[model samples]
Target: MAGENVLVAVEGRRLQLSNLDKVLYPSDGFTKGEVIDYYSRVAPVLLPHLAGRPLTMRRYPDGVDGQSFYEKNAARHAPDWVRTVTVDTPGSSTGAETLDFAVVDDLPTLVWAAQMASLELHIPQWTVGPRGGRNNPDRLVFDLDPGPPATIVECCRVALLLREKLRADGLEPVAKTSGSKGMQLYCTVTTTAPKQAWGYAKELAEQLAAEHPGLIVARMAKNLRPRKVFIDWSQNHEYKTTVAPYSLRARERPTVSTPITWAEVESCREPGDLVFTADDVLDRVDEHGDLFKPLLRKKNPPKLTALKSR
Candidate 1:
């Protein structure tokens, strides 16, 4: 892990990288250089979703298998040019405190984060808003996580069902692999109210779980995770974060959270169908532009509470 420094200019920005040859994914022998290269290459497409969001960086200083830590507060060492957003956090019992979170405003900052050996990027459902305005969730996520003995295929089936329900509510939905063993579905939200998204998602999840008892579980209880897939509605909260699409995972191997088409979701028959490595994801982006872009783009928000009126 002890290596010398190598200076490089990233888009005219100076960065000194160390231990680029350090193995992060020892199982596949993928080095830190490969991680940096992957983020740098994917920055153009990846940055849009990350534009104004506070990033909870997952740094793998000793690689994926080794010691890893989540960095919420921007490092004090960060250069002045690196943009950050200060948001209020619920502290103690009386009031709130501010946290300075890194906002990857440009490709230079993206590469610099890679220089820190941050293997994964996770962003909240909402952005920091213009001029760091009110934090609200612009989208909602339904994380279909399967229990043991079940896999991505099961989650895929459940995702399709969730998609249909969201579509019925007059909202278009998109599906993506979680880069690990699970899958996530996203829908563009119109409400700026902090609780609307979570309320809608929780209601929908409970309704579905009630409609299909054995196959689904909406509650976040450990005992409920037997041969069932959990619809994680809790991700819709403003304080929570979901894995950024196209971000790398800290799994045993370097897998990416790649977006998928609806047809791909329909044809997903097994776990392997949902997996994409860093190289595979890069190739996919080259062939097809970002399909998950709609979630972050301006769109009409559906009155999810109206669905309850039915």
Candidate 2:
């Protein structure tokens, strides 16, 4: 019993009903109470982990297949603060029914979206990003990304190693899944000239690659990294786009870009071992607060700049 209100439509006619606290999602229905329950359970773990910032959750209806559905509707609900955009959809639709909400705010919104999209529609999985929401950030993506056969553990190791090095340079590094087989390392920096940002990231990545040799490969093209992780700098460009923050991808089981703790990184050996579902992410969010908040505050978000040289 979160509350009472259901905005519905009948035969092309809209109807507003009172004392209706239940949400009738095509995949699964939830009452406002359920959403609130999840929030209370998860917020504690998620709040501290955030980069000391407010979170912006991307709702994927019916999982990744429902990405387009969400993207089309996101414009209406997304707060005015988002900036960076990336999508993790598998490029397909779930082919399921959908419902709409007028104002889905706060952590409750996340629980409702996950339950409805994942449980109700049965889409594959979901991926997520930091809650810069419109003002989030256009990350300087160093895709030290590896391909199949690369264990998640190995990828995470590379990420952690990079994290240590980046921290020494006064840059905060936050890691997330590529929503595929690799990991993405995002560093928050001041809105220096775009060239400065790109130059800083490129230099750092290239230096790391040189230090690791076989373990780290710095190449712009995918073909170059037949088996190694490529440090992609193109994402650092101002106009360049990554996946939308909460866009879903077309995976059969529906996974999300859930956060991982340094403890998990220290203990795990493969990325596959860390796959997380929509039902489980909020708990982690509660545990960690926001991992990207430190970096976001250190660096003043993204800014427009002329392209810089390598």
lDDT of 1 by residue, 6-79 (tens): 88987888888889889999999999889999998998789998888898899999998889887877857577
User: How badly does each model clash, as a count of residue pairs?
Assistant: 0, 58
Error of 2 at 104 (Å): 11
Provide the TM-score for each candidate, comma-separated.
0.95, 0.56
Off by over 4 Å in 2: 1-139, 243-249, 296-310
RMSD of 1: 2.1
lDDT of 2 by residue, 1-310 (tens): 4345566542333433332344423244543334434444654443233322222344443333345333322334443432223332233264323322122223443343333332221111111234322233334556656754555666777888788876666555667665556656765544534455566667777887889877767766665666566676656654343442222333544344555556766677756667764455654565666554543353354442333321
lDDT of each: 0.86, 0.48
Point out the worst 10-residue segment of candidate 1 by lDDT.
89-98
Model 2: per-residue Cα lDDT at residue 39:
41
CA-RMSD of model 2: 9.6
Considering every candidate listed, which one attains the maximal TM-score?
A: 1
